[model samples]
Target: MKIMKTVQKVPGGMMVVPLLIGAIINTVAPHALKIGSFTTAVFSSAGVASFVGLQTFFVGTNLKFKEAPEALRRGSVLLVAKYLAGLILAIITNKIFGLSGFLGISVLAIICSVTGSNGSLYLSLMGTYGDSKDTAAQGILNIHDGPFLALITLGASGLASIPLLSLLAAIVPLLVGCILGNADKDLRDFFSPGASIVIPFVGFTIGAGINFSLIIKAGLSGILVGLLVFFVGGGLSILADRYINKRPGYAGAAIASAAGNTIASPAAIAIIDPKYKPFVASATTQIAAAVVLTVIIVPPLVAWMAKRYGCPKFDEQKAKNASLQES
Candidate 1:
């Protein structure tokens, strides 16, 4: 049946299909796999962070010491571009609608939802359409995964004491793996397969955390947030990659999706600032919808952009072959 080949033909299918399967399980039974032990661990929401951490470590192993500098530049540009997109739109939303935004969308939702990029999904996409250096840059994109960056940008930087450890906690695993891999080629090869191995699980765990019902609940406003995520994140980020980073912009487009962890950011921000408390529920739902939508939207966007710009996917010698034949 060529099952693996068939799956690979779908845009971001490796990650996306598992995510949808998990979402279906959650939506239907929602408790069938929560019986503890490895079953629950592998098939439920319990493994989200663990799977992501494991995936990050694997991605690090593929990166060479020589490529780290350019990876940093690419990753940093993506991080800034994603953040700025969220901040600009969020500030404009705030000016227009204030904290209690109209149609159930808030500044908090815009900031938290759009600013963060999905690291697991990015790694999977890069595996399909990018090279080792491009995937290694996931280490830097790891920083904005949770509430840390949004908190700082939300005026909490000066007044409130935010936890720097959360940010450190995300990056440290990737850094350690990179260090160990750079120190030993054998170790790098050993862990190299580990990243791709964990991808489907990462998607499943994250999807278990999501409820498709939220997309229905979010409605028009939710759809708007999702489109905002794709357009703003994709648009600005692609431009930043081309002009600022001086590279093909497929990477920026790839990273335009919301982080799976972002659904929690509204509540996290609300806890720190009571002003956001009233909007948390609505924002969370909207962000949840945005997360799902972007995962669907951005992958194909990246695939198309990669083909358009000639990215070097490890799996795609054909892309290179086509380039040579044309020349």
Candidate 2:
């Protein structure tokens, strides 16, 4: 049907299309796909946990130690910048609205939604507009896939306290993947590609768990959160890339979206603190909507920024080198 080709034409179509379809299916006929064991397992929220764990493992396998240094450097700059911006939002929301949340948005939801960046989207944009080091930056940045960042921010902000073990448990899949991928080149080769391949399943699973009605309730707020992340996070990241990394600033803007995995955060937090349970469903839908919103908007914004304000240092150096050769 050329569906994939059509979807590919969109900036984040690979993940967004499946998520939307899954949401529609879940919304229209919640039990229509539960016809069999396999369908029941794959087409429901129960399946999301499994897929996320596996997808995380695959993402981990792509993190080779060889890429660690540059990845850590650039990744940390972007992560800290994005995280702080989110933390500020959390604090503001707390002061203004309190933990119960304001206008259907919880402090936990806002922090969780904004802190996670879409690694695939960032890497895709980096591949198009950046150099090798930029691409490798995903290594450290990818660690935000799960709930650890939100938990940490909550704990640090004194809004919620999490157990030490839960924090460790959050990273187990990533650590395991890194170990396996580093230990065997064959394993890395086999699983690294699966990271991208598994994204559709990730999207579908996230969507399947979401109730579209919740999306309706969180619609405007979700879009607002997405915009906040895209502009504020992008701005913080661009400054870091320019001043901290001393590179073109577009790499920071490239990380402007909420990762699809972040749709799971509120539920994860609810697991730790029952106080958060009431907010989980709505937060999931909100984050899911935010993921779609950012995916649609961030890539083009990054491309435009790169073209207009990209650091000329690298390109100018290439120009000089070319002229010297011509002379």
Q: Which candidate is the best by TM-score?
A: 1
lDDT for each residue of candidate 1 in 176-254, tens digit (9 for 90 to 100): 8889999999999899888778878887887787777878888988988898889997799999988998777788888
TM-scores for all candidates: the values are: 0.89, 0.64
Q: Which candidate comes out best when scored by lDDT? A: 1
Clashes of 2: 0
Candidate 2 ranges beyond 4 A from true positions: 1-68, 156-217, 311-327
Backbone Cα, N, C clashes tallied per candidate: 0, 0
What pairs collide in candidate 2? none
Per-residue lDDT of 1-327 in model 2, one digit per residue for the tens?
998899867545666677678878887998876677988788765676576566667756767667567767988899898888788888988998888677777887788878889875675555446654565566567656778789888773354543456546645776788789889999988986665676677667656755556546667878777777787777787888889988768888888888777888888788777888888877787787777677667866776676677533346667999999999
